[model samples]
Structure formats: structure tokens, C-alpha cells
Target: MVDGRRITRRRFLQDSARAASALALTAWGLEGARGTASAQELSFPVERGASLRVLRWSQFVTTDRPIFEQNAARFTQRTGVPVRVEYETWTDVQPKAAAAANVGSGPDIVIGFFDEPHLWADKLVPVTDLAQYLGRKYGGWFDVCPQYGYSPQRNAWIAIPIGAPGVAINYRVSWVREAGFDPDPARFPRTTDEFLRLCRALRARGHPTGFALGKAVGDGNTWVHWCLWAFGGRVLAPDNRTLTINSPETANALEYARALYETMIPGVAGWLDPHNNRAFLAGEISLTNNGISIYFAAKNDFPEIAQDMNHAVFPVGPVGRPTELHLFSQAYIFSYTRYPNAAKEFLRWIMEDTQYARWINGMLGYVSHPLRAYTNLTVWRSDPKALPFRDAVARMLPHSYAGRPGPEAARAMAEFVVVDMFADACTGRRSVRDAIRAAEDRLRRIYRS
Candidate 1:
């Protein structure tokens, strides 16, 4: 155990992969759709003898896999196509995807996280027609959807965004109340300064907060990026050309980060994505930022904690409005797949309102929709605590914040440039100024290429 807490996988992943688990599309079926009317008639003939292998991140919520498998079974029973779905730890998905792209063989379809499609756009089959049809039929994509799925270089959609696993503040109501702060959403901290005060107050009561500072792929990146942008700090200018991370705003963010870090439970500097989740469930941390997984786990395993837990959106910072970052998952077909038509059809079938709604509802509020119409889904309002996550996509800023989307932003994030900057200062390895300067230098090398 690290820091007297057990390190373990989310229990859902253990049994989900073994659960029991579709459709063929003719090449012309997707291509023929010019509008919503034609889209309804889309019966992409499944390529004869087509079978698919799909790789996705492990389920963060318990019901996610069974419902997903049930949907796949429905697709197969209806369309006479077979599908095999596999799961990997989320952090491992990127390298496995890279291997698939490099060797031209692996899972036929990969459902992975943020900007992965951008990293290998040239090697994937374009789904622009399918994307367009879905857009017309399902209202329209969110503002950040195209930024991740549509490739500027290819002038097409290399991937389809499935949903975002919304991240927000998870805290114990009793601890928050005892710490002398109201636990109500409306009464929660509304500014970064107030947030720091809350953290400090919680610590004074022996219930310190925690946020990842290590090289965690999801949690680490989400919270750090939010902190950076919340104070108006950015890696590049609006043109996406000039390096601008060394400014006063960034220094302010780092100084603030250092203060927050002081109020955190010990050992956060080495905490990974799952660390805070474990600590929170173990009742070692009074507060932390995470997706809905923590609440579900507590609901099932520790009823007392679950009863006292509540969620809220991050407070507004110096930049003024909400500036949160969430992990977005998207699916793409490798060009080498022998069943491209079947792959396209499977994606389309699952994203259809019927199957998509079932899959999303099963996740409860764990996953937020990328399509605008899904904002009205019943799951968002299923529980009062789920309400904060309902607008994650709508409230989020894309990677690189004020700058454009491209490989530079993806590369910087993959390398943990932002997370490490905060780690450096908070851990006392570097002063706040040095940490900002180091981040600026690293970003310059990345954006210059």
C-alpha cells in the first residue's frame, strides 16, 4: 500500500471484460446519405463475412460494460454481423493504438481518449459522411466535437467522439460542513481564492483535499489544465504560433497551485489517476476532483460516505467564467481493417438514438454526450449530484485553451508538460517562476516543430 491506502483497479474492470457480447454496412449506404431523410434509409449492407475487433478503455462505471455488450448483441442479432470487444487500462490505449497504426494491424476499431485520432489521422478511414449524417439527425455536434474528431489536414472526420467522462469536485458533506463551509452547490466556493480557503479550512479540520500531480493520463491532466487556464495562463497565443506560458498570469496560477498543494493530503505529488479515487473512498481525503466513479463505488461499498458525498463544478477563476477540462473518448477505424463498411455501420448503429441512449443511461452520469440533443437525456437529471456534470462538454475549453488544435497541443499534453509544471513548484523541486519558465521552454520546443 502507498501512503497507507490500497492501490487497486476500479472493481468494475475486473468482471466487465468477461461479460457476454453486429452489423454490416454496404459502402454506399453511408455515402448515399445527403440529408436526414436519406439518413433514415441508411441500411449499409454489412460486408459479407465481416467480423470486427474493438478495443476500448476499461469501464469506469459498473453498468457500462453489460449495457454496451447488450447493445452489441442487439446489433448482431439484427444485422447478422459479429463483434468482439476488448478492454485495456485507459493509459495503455494510446500506445496500443500507436502500435496498431505503425504496424497496420490490431483492433479493427479503437475507442480511445482525447486527440488520439489527430495523432494518426492519415492511417484511419474517414467517417465524414457518417459524421455529417449523425449531425443532421441528432441536432448537431458540440463546439468541441469537431475540434477533436475532424481532421483539418484530411478535411474529414477521422474519428467519432462518443462522450466525455465529466470530472468535478467530489467532497464529503459532513466534512465540508464541519470545516465551516456550506455544502450546497449555490453556497460552494465561486472563485479560486475561495476554493483555496475551503481547501485550507478542510485541512485544518484534518480532512485535507487531494488532486493528482504525477503523470496521470486522465485525472492529472484534467485538473492541472483547468488550474492553468482558470487563471488565464496558456501555452500559446491565439494564433497558436507564439510561446506565451511565461507570463504573469501563469506565475499567478503556479503560486496559487503551490498554496493549494500545501492543503492537500501528503503523497499527492506521486498520485496517479486512481490515487485520489482510492484515497477518497478510503476516507483519507475529504475532497478531490474526479468523475462519477467515486460516488458509485461509495454508494455500493460504503453507504455512509456515499450518503455524505456531493458534487459541484469547479469555481470560476481569475479568467472569470468556468474553465474545466474533461477526458473525451472517440472511436476510429484503422484503414487496414478488412471490414471498413461493417466498422462504419457498427459505429453508426451504436450511436443511433436507440442504442446510444441505452449505453449512456447505463453509465448514469459517468459519461457526458457529445451531441447537443443528448443534453436532455434522463440520466443527467437522474440524481441531484449528477447535475453538475450535465454540461461538462458545453462548459469545457479544448486543449491548448486559447490556441488552435493540432499535434503541438496533443504532444505537450501527452508529455505531461502542464502537470509537471505544477508538480515542480508544489513539490519544491523548483520555484514557481522556474516551473513556469521550464514549462515555457518545453512548450517552445514542441510548438516550434
Candidate 2:
């Protein structure tokens, strides 16, 4: 059964690749339409006699999995090649891939998060050449895509963003209205002082604001990065080389975070991503910052709460309103893949416009096309059911910031700064300043080691 919207083959492969690269183009200050390559340029000499194995997030595939069986059947029929897909979660997949690489049995294709390229640098094949190939086949790379997964020092494209989960403020419109507040743009809090006042007002009216502070890496790290940006703290220097988390601005940010923590629900320190989502869904909290997936998850399971919840662009911080653009688990090809060309072709196929629509729509609205052009589609941009989310993305894109690129630094920040310090501050085990200072010391030790 055809499950999603479809586009022509040429439009699927060629146009999509060009569109994907558009984000990178804009980041580099380039201007042009995407996908101007002729069909002849995209025609590849097929090496049909190759077989490949792929490993991906286990939730996306299964052996007894009916979905995997169906998709694999179609893939084999289309390519005339044997294919195997192994599935595992991020925690399981990384160690498995590492162990497999050591034993020379790693899968040909690997799907990992944006940090994976940096985390598994030794195992990755710099697919930076894919940009050139995309240019030849489609037209040119987008401004944002290249930046998301490329490492300049490594001179390789270790990963490609298949999707992006933009962050935003999720609030209950019903509660806000009942609390005698108009949260419209003109009246919305734009500064930290105003935000605090609003939170106090909401609290007086019995609406507690929720911010993710759980011990899980996903929510905890997100809290640190988003709060830091909101408070005008720089995680790294402009050159992407220096750790600037110990700056005065960072201290100020941490202080603000501590104050905000004081106003949050009592047990927020123990709540992870799902816990925060549940808090909002169960009407325990009024406002929180989270990924678009939370909305999808809510809408899928509980339509009543979904209708009451609305999304807004994160309030502008002292420096500016900076939202986190989270690049979730993405796909990559392994250097050890025996059929690199075929693997690339498979990637190209899946990323093609038609197949992309299937993958995305099938995911119950959890995924978003990373490119602006694709995001401009009717389903993404104009759907009435998604208007709030679409508006959130539009407002966030210009001011979006990414955390430290590599997994090592990101993990360190999560383990040290977020889980240890921030969580402690929330729970009153340590003051914010002391926690941040301790985190800085811990980070220095980590990097030095």
C-alpha cells in the first residue's frame, strides 16, 4: 500500500538533495535555486551486483517486525540486491557498532545522531564528497545541511541530518486565558524580568511552569543549552574551538537558571523528557520548552490535551531569543561498507522526495524536513493542525543555535554540567554559581584527560 505523498523520481532524488543542501547554502551566504542539475548529470553507472547490511535505531526496524519485512521486500525487488537491516537504540547501537568495527563486522550503513559523526569519527567515511556528488546530480548543497553534519577540521561529512527537532515553548492556552493573560505576541514576555513576572502571576493563579531538568541526557542537556542561550551565554567561541562556559555571561545565565528553577515544580529535577511531557499533558504544568515531537506524541495519544496545548517561540533572552535546533538521530554510511556506492544510492533513494514523504508522514509527524524548501510544503507549512508548530519553526530558524558539535564534549556537558550541577541546583543540593563553577572544573578535567 502506498502510504504517503509521492513525487516524480527525478524530483525525488535530484530536487530533494538540492533542497537538503539549501540550509548549508544560506548559512554560507549563498543564493540560488536548489536542484538545477540535468537528468543526464544525475544518471549513475549502476553496480547492480552488490549486497549491503544496514544498522539503525531498533525502534525503526525489527526482525519479527512486519514493517521491516515489508520495506526490505520492496527494497530487494527494486534494487535486485540482498539487504539486511539490524536495529537497536542509541545506547545499544553505539557500543555494538564500536565492537563490530573492532571485529570487522560493522554494518555497511549506520544511522546515528548528529553527534555520532564526531563520536565515531574513526569509523566514519568522510562523505564530504557527497556534497559534490549532490551538486552534480541535483544542483548545489543547501546552506544549513552542510553545517549540521560537517566538520571543517576533519574535512569530512560524518553525518547528514535526516530531520531536525526544533525547540519551542509549549503552554496551555486554556490556563493562560483563565489566568487573565493574553499570550499574544504583542503582550508576550520578551525579557527575563517579564518572564519571571509572568511565571509568578501564573503560579499565583495555580499554574506551575515546567522546565525539563531530568537526569536523562536528552532533556538535561537540552535544558542547559537552551537556558544558556536564553541567558546570553556562549557555549563556545565563534571559531568553534574555545570553551566559553566559564565566562561572565555564562555565570549570569546560570544565575537566571537557578532563579527559574526556584519557581518550577518541586520534583522537576527527577523528571526526564517523558516526565516533563506527561506533566504538561496531565495538566500539572502550564509552560515548558521541548521538541516538536512532544506535540506529536501528545496529539497521537490524547487529542484533548493536544488541543489545549499550544506552541510559541521561546522568549527572547537578554542576548536574544535563541532556540535550540536539535538534530536527532541521523543517517550515515560506514567506511567499511563493502558497497559504498550502493549504500549511497540507497541513501539517495530514501531521501528522495517521494520516499521522504512516506518516512515522515508515517512517523506520525515526529520528523521534519531539515531544508527550508521542504518545510515550505503544504503538509508542513499550512496545515491547520500544525499551524502553531509551523509558526514556531519559522520564528526559531533565524535564531537557532546548536550545542557543542561532538559527542565527547556534549556527553561531558551532560554528565558534568547538566546531570551533576544543574540537576543539583534544581534540587537545592548546590547553588547555581557553585554548581556552574564545579561543572567548569569538571569539564576542564575531562578535556585535559
Candidate 3:
């Protein structure tokens, strides 16, 4: 057992491969459009003798990879097109996908993180037909769903908004109870002011808490972004034309993070996505923000911790509602595919009701309902433990906040601008005003271009 809490391979490598695609795209650059047509008539990819390739991030929920492969195998049986599937760590998927887009060859499809479809809109074929088909089969898209893949500029869907994996506050129930709060995860805390108070209490009881402060490909930037929006702050206004991050609400959020930093583990300044999962499982931390992988890991490897842990929505902020920016777990069909029809067919099948239910059941709460209609899957109602993560899509705010998610917002988040702003203040690299000024300056430059 590492650090006295048993660590499983799932917890260890889940995000190991999730959500770094856009960051890589930022450094190397390339990332998609929106359409909602339901016509599936395709003439290319010659249905007979066509083979397909699919590449996706290896999931934190260990069961997810195998579940997808099983469905792919079933698709091959049904369609006679042999499918080749490969899994990359989340970090590698972006760069690899970018390379494919750069050369105009490789996998027919990919699963990438948020705004990624926007980043590579120029290189992707619009999946309006597939998206519209699924939305009708399931319920209509979640509010932020269209923003992820559909761009009004091109009047097409550059990529499909497959699903979103939401991040929330994962904590040890026993520790919170010891801290004098009710043990129920739902009642834990729903406001920033109270969340900080809970952190101090847990720290006093010997289980120091944390979320990554460094540029964690996923978790680090996620929590930082949460704090920003919680206090009536946003990186951009609704129009996407003006920068709106330098405000009193933004400063209040940063100051709250500064206070939170003091109560966390000493090395969080350098921590990334996996650190919190490892820390919590090792019994080193009591609470933090993350997906359901923590409880999933504990259930399999550290049973006691499993019983003691649960995931919760972010506490209500000054806005008085959870402005959760659910992580993007979207799939895209690349324009380079010779088997475009076969690739689209595979996606359509995997997303259908029976197969979608099977895939989600395997991951349990690790993957939340991407579509509002898919919310009734047995996984949420079957297991009481999975209840808190069920409303992930419901709690979401588009990653761009009030602004439309497109090139400008995509560039800002991909480069981790707002994340750096909060990190700088917490790490003492910049005062609150300077950090906000620097972020605003950087965002203005991105939107101006």
C-alpha cells in the first residue's frame, strides 16, 4: 500500500490519460464547428470492405475501456467492418490527434477534452447528422452541449458533443463527521464561505485537504476555474467580445483560494491531477474536488475508505447556484478518414440506448450523464453511492461561462490563463490585482485576434 491506503491501477492512471488534448493543441496548435441536421445518407467510405480506427483517452474508471471495446467488437459483427481501437493516456491523445490532423491521416475518430472540437474545427467534418440523431433518440442536448461542438459561424457541427464528465467535491465522510458536520455528502457544504470553514476543520483533525494548484491537465485548472465562477466572476461576458475577469467577485474568489491554500498539504503548489486521488486513497487527504474515480478506487482497493467517501456538487457561490464547468469527454470524427461512413456508423451505434446504458453502467459514477435524457440509467438509481454525481450535466456551465464557446474562449482555456491567475495568487507569484490584470490582458489578446 502506498502511504497506507491501497492504490488501484484505475485510480493511478485514469486521468493519467484524460483531458490534456487542448493544452497540447495550445502548445502545438490545432483543435472544430457545429451542425444539427439528421440526414445520415452517406455515399463515401464504401460500406463494404471498409475498416475503421478509433482512438480515445484511457478512462480513470477501469471498466470503461473494456466496455467500449466490447461494444466496438459488437459493431464489427453487425457491420462487417473490422474496427481497430487504441487507447492513449489523456495527455497523449491531444498531441497524437493533432499530429493526425496535421498530416491529414490516422484514426477516423478521437475522444478529446473541452473546446477541443472548437480548436480543430477547421480539420474536422461536421457531425451534425450524427449529433441530431442522438439528441432525438436521447433527450435534446444539455444547454452547454451545443456550445461544445456547434459553431454558428460555420453553421455546422465541427465535432460531436458526446458527453461531459463532471468534477465535484470528493471527500471522506468519516472525516467530515469527525469535523462535526452531518455525514451526508449532499449536506456537506454549498457555499464558498462554508467550504473554507470545512477545510480548516478537516485540517485541524489531521487530514489536510487539497486540489492541484499547478497546471494539472484537468483537475488543477478545474478547481481554479470553479473558484472564479463561484463568486460572480467570469473570464468573459455573454457577448464573448469583452473581457470580464478583472472584478471584485474575481478577487474574492482568489482570496478564498489563498486562505484554502494554507489548510492544504505542503506540496500542492506542484501537485497535478493524480496527486489528489493518490493522497485521498493513501489516507493523506480528507477532501478535495474531482470525479468519481476516488470512490471507485476505494471501493475496489481500499474498502474502508470507500465506505467513508462520497462526491458532492460544488457549494453554491455568490451567484447562489453551482456554476460547475463539467469536463469535456467528447468524441470527434476526423475529416481524414477514408472510412468516414463506417466511423460515423460506429459512433451512432455506441451512443444508442442499449449500448450507452451498458457503457455507463460499467463506469458507474465515473462518467456522468452527458445528455439530460440519459439520466435514468440504472447506475445512478441502483447504487446510492453514485447519487451525488448523477446531476453533473445539470450543474454545468459552458466552459466559456457566459460567453459562447469558440476560438477565443477555446484559446483562453487551452492556454490555462484563468487557472494561472488563481495559481499565481495562491503561490505568491503575483498579488491578486496583478494576477487578474495579467489574465485579463492575456484573454483580451486572445479575443482580439
Candidate 4:
């Protein structure tokens, strides 16, 4: 276990206030250099007769795709390079990107989830120049972005962190109040024990929470990682080489999972990414964790639910601070692409403040920006509901926190090692000791020295 004194309530609250507050765009005092300097400092020449194919994950909200395509069309019109954008279901992106990397031919660029570029760093083009330029132009990236974008093996940036459709606590306001807990972001439960009490109280009122336990690439792994790390459990030590998942801290987390699972709605054991969304929208679940997609859907269709829903960051655990894991997306160009220049330029064009701001505001903060300067965007401040999600990327612990991002971390996460370990304990499929031992064995093989 880690030193308990490492974090304190006073420190946590201080950090929470910083994260919850939306700082000004000029927070870095670079308001004058925002757009004009970027065009002058860096420019990629378009390759002749170049046509680009980009692969990205399918959209959760309908508006996201149209805005993306509109920006792509603008890129083509300005550069005379035709671009085609295709999407894969969230679960298929990693495997498909791996396959393309192995074959040396496919889409010129891929926008995939966290640490994926690390899994095939050698096969991807280094965007160090572009990444650094963006950082200087924007306020700079959040701390977690570099964990996904920079590859230690290559000593360069293998990907461009776009943004994260951050997962937050999605709860029904009335349900929380009925259970005698205030749903306000400031007044919500601050610790895991307090959170458990709220969950049990909700269950007693005939409303229960549900979190995915199945092989959900996004939701399942995200929450399970939070549960494990909440009590100071970590998959690997700081060296990124030592196996450290089986311990007293891990056992405590598993015991807590078992208790939390009891208060959840039935069949969470089989729940995938979409299950909780459906349940909550159907009024069968009183609380869950999700992106702004839930609120978006409710606003468009279920007005009453939209009015009643609220969001907050996950509760602090025994660790005395936030140890959250959210869905992060990054983009990478393939080494084998014929039009590397065209691909690079296209990426650069869309990430410019003009195009990026339009896309972000259109999506209404479904995807939290990785650049710190974006915290000042009107989208975050336009609606009170989106404010809780604005700094999620800034506050989250990336995959392999306390370690480094690499093929081992990516492979372990993709294989669902942590998710399954928590699932096994929560479902009573294995005793807590067995679950920890089994997870340790799997992690040992993955992180073999």
C-alpha cells in the first residue's frame, strides 16, 4: 500500500476547487498569440494528388459527426485534398488499428482511444513538431495528454491527443434528494464511504445504481479502474515493471466492490457500455456514470429527465484524492501513408482554434478539450450542466498511472485484466484472494521482465 499521508482532505478539496473552476483562456497570458502565430510558426505542405482516409470512432451524439464532417469538408475546400472519414464501433477501433499497423496499409490516420498509439508506436509517424506547436499556441495540454501522446521508446510524440468524452457521475436529482443527499456538486458525497451510503439509500427507495461489469471497452474498464485505484491499488509499481496489484489495498477495494455491487440493479454482471444508458433513460436506474451523451439524449427526447439530471466528479476515496480514469482519444498518422504531409496538414487545419471551437461548441462539451486554453470556451460556460465535465481530462489519472504508458499497459487494459478482476470479485465468481491472485498472475505475464 502507498503512504496514507501522501494525500489529505485539505489538499484534495483545494485541488477539487481548481479543477471545478473554469479558468480564463488567457490564463497563460497568451491571448495575443492564439491564432496568428500558429499559422506563421508551422505549416505542412500538401502532397500532390493526395487523398486521405481517416478512421475514427462512431459518434455518441448525432451532432458530433456532422460538425466533424463539415470541418473535413472545409479542409478539403481550402487544400484541394479529398478526405474520407470512416468510423468503427468503439470496441473495434483498437483491433482494427493494430491490424492496419501490421499490414502497413489502411487509413492514413486513426483517432483511437488512450494509449493505443503506444501499442504500435514504431508503426506510427511522430508528430512532435505539431504537438509542441499546439501546446504553445493553446494554453498547453493537460498533464494526462502527454501520457497518451508521447512515446518513450520513440522519444517522440506518436499521437495527438484530441479530447476525451469524459465519464462523470450521472445521477437523478430527485432520487438523490429523496435519499437525503444533496445533488449539488459542492454538497455531494466527498468520500467512498459516503458514496456507498448514498447508493444503499437509493436502493432502499426502490431506485438502484448500475455500472458495467462486462467486457465494455470504455465503461467497464473505466469504472473498475476507478474502484481499484480509489483504495490505493495499482496494477504496476512506479517503475512500470513491478507487479503490485495483489495487496491489502486491492483486497479492501474488492470488498468495497462487493458491497457496492449488492446495491446495484440486477444483471450489472452482464451489462455492457449501453446498458446503463438504457436503464437510466428508462427510469429503471437512479444513478450511473456516463458522458454528456445521456443528458444530450434526454434533452432531445425526455424533457422531464433532462430537467432532473445532474452531474458531479467521482467521489474521493481513502486515497484522499481523485483517482479517476476516463475515456481519452488521440490521433496518429501511419508511417506507411503515401500523403504524410497532406494528412498532417489536414489534422493541423481541423485543430486550429476556429474549426476546433466550432466542433466543440456544437458537441456541447461531450468531448472535453485536452488543451488547457479550451477551458475558457463558451461551451463549458454556456450551460451549468457541462461545467462538471469540463475539467475531467485535467483531473483524471491516465491508464498506467504511477507508471508509464506503453505496449504492456495498453495490452493489459485491452485484455480487460483489471476489469475482469473486479468483475470476478463483485459477481462472487471468485473469492477476493483468488481474484487478486489471478489478476496478479495475468499482470505478471504481461509485464514480464
- All candidates' TM-scores? 0.90, 0.78, 0.88, 0.91
Q: Could you give candidate 3's per-residue lDDT for residues 1-449 as a string of tens digits?
A: 77898878997676455446434322221221112343344322436778988888877878988988999999888878898898887667878987898898889899888877677787787777676666655655665666676766657766766676668788888889899887686677877888888999999989899888776767886788778888889887887787889999999999989999988998887887788999989999888888888888888999999887877778887888777777777788887777778877887788777888898888886777666667888888888878877887776787788888887787787688987898899989999999999998898889888
- lDDT tens digits, residue span 87-169, model 1: 99888888899999999999999999888888888899999878878876776677777778877788788899898999999
Q: Give RMSD to native, each candidate.
A: 13.5, 9.7, 13.3, 7.2
Where does model 4 exceed 4 Å of error?
1-40
lDDT of 2 by residue, 1-449 (tens): 13686777876799778776675554433334255644233323336588878887644211123444455567678878688888775446666766766776678877765455565666666655444454344444444455546665565667655665445667777777777767663466667777777777778788888876765445556556666777666545655455666667777777777778766777787775567777877888888876555566677777887787776655667776554544355577777777777777666666555665555554433455654445554556434445444433234321123334665554563353545666765666777677777877776676556
Better of 1 and 3 by TM-score: 1
Candidate 1 TM-score over all chains jointly: 0.90
The candidate scoring highest on TM-score is 4
Q: Give the TM-score of candidate 4.
A: 0.91
Residues 149-250 of candidate 4: C-alpha lDDT, one tens digit per residue: 888688788888899998989999999999999989789898999999999999999999999998887788878888889999998888888788988999
- Which segments of candidate 1 are over 4 A away from where they belong? 1-41
Clashes of 3: 21
Q: Work out candidate 2's RMSD over C-alphas.
A: 9.7
Alpha carbon lDDT of each predicted model:
0.85, 0.61, 0.79, 0.88
